[model samples]
Target: MKTASFPSLRVEPKLRQDTESVLYDNESLSQFIESAVRQQVELRKANTEFLARGLASRDNARQTGQYVEAVDVLEKLQNRLDQHKAKHTTK
Candidate 1:
């Protein structure tokens, strides 16, 4: 596999100790930190993509006049909940 180097990070003493303790049993600290950084970067990329898609969907809904106001949505949900509670309470 290809290899890359990361600059040294000055972490808190306790954080460094915790990382080292977890890494001591299996892999080197460098490998653990590299894997962690890579995972974080990928996670952020996925989150950005998800937010972009959601915004696009909202824009489409708005353009089609399909988007309901927050108050309207809340009222619908509240009505449903009230109906559900009424039914269950009487049973």
Candidate 2:
């Protein structure tokens, strides 16, 4: 696949030095920056999805007036966790 290049970033010298210091063996500064950009892109996408789901749930609740109480939800979740743990545990 043909790759396109993004514009270069001009960061402070000290910040650049600190970032370069943490790279693993044989890793380049450009590689580190690219990995960081990729991670931020993934995180932002996840965050946006989370917000959209919450908004949709809110709208559905408003339209239908049906909702689970927080305490009931927490209790159900805790019970499921305990069941899962029991199944996974040895002994």
Candidate 3:
């Protein structure tokens, strides 16, 4: 595969030293930076999706004048947690 060069990133000496200090034996600085950038991109995408879902829920509630009671929501969440715990504990 042909790889093109990415823009050069410049950081302070202390930041560079700190980053290098935590790397594994087989890891390279370029690989670490690339991984960090990829993680950040994924995190931003997830945040965007979360915001969209929240906005859609708000619009739906406004249109229908319907919303779940907090107590009901909490009960459902607790039930899910309990079910998950039971499954994991038996494994």
**Candidate no. 3 TM-score:** 0.82
> How well is each residue in 1-91 modelled by candidate 3, as lDDT tens digits?
9987789989999999999999989999999999999999999999999999999999999999999899999999999999999989954
After superposition, the stretches of candidate 2 with alpha carbons farther than 4 Å from their true spots are 77-91
- Model 2 Cα shift for residue 9 (angstroms): 0.8
* Best by the lDDT measure: 2
Q: By TM-score, is 2 or 3 better?
A: 3
lDDT of 2 at 50: 100
Query: Which residue pairs does candidate 1 place in steric collision?
Result: none
TM-score of 2: 0.80
TM-score of each: 0.65, 0.80, 0.82
* lDDT of candidate 1 over 1-85, digit per residue (tens): 9976777789899998998888856699888988998899999999999999999989999899887789998999999999999
Q: Candidate 2 at 28: error in angstroms?
A: 0.6
lDDT of candidate 3? 0.95
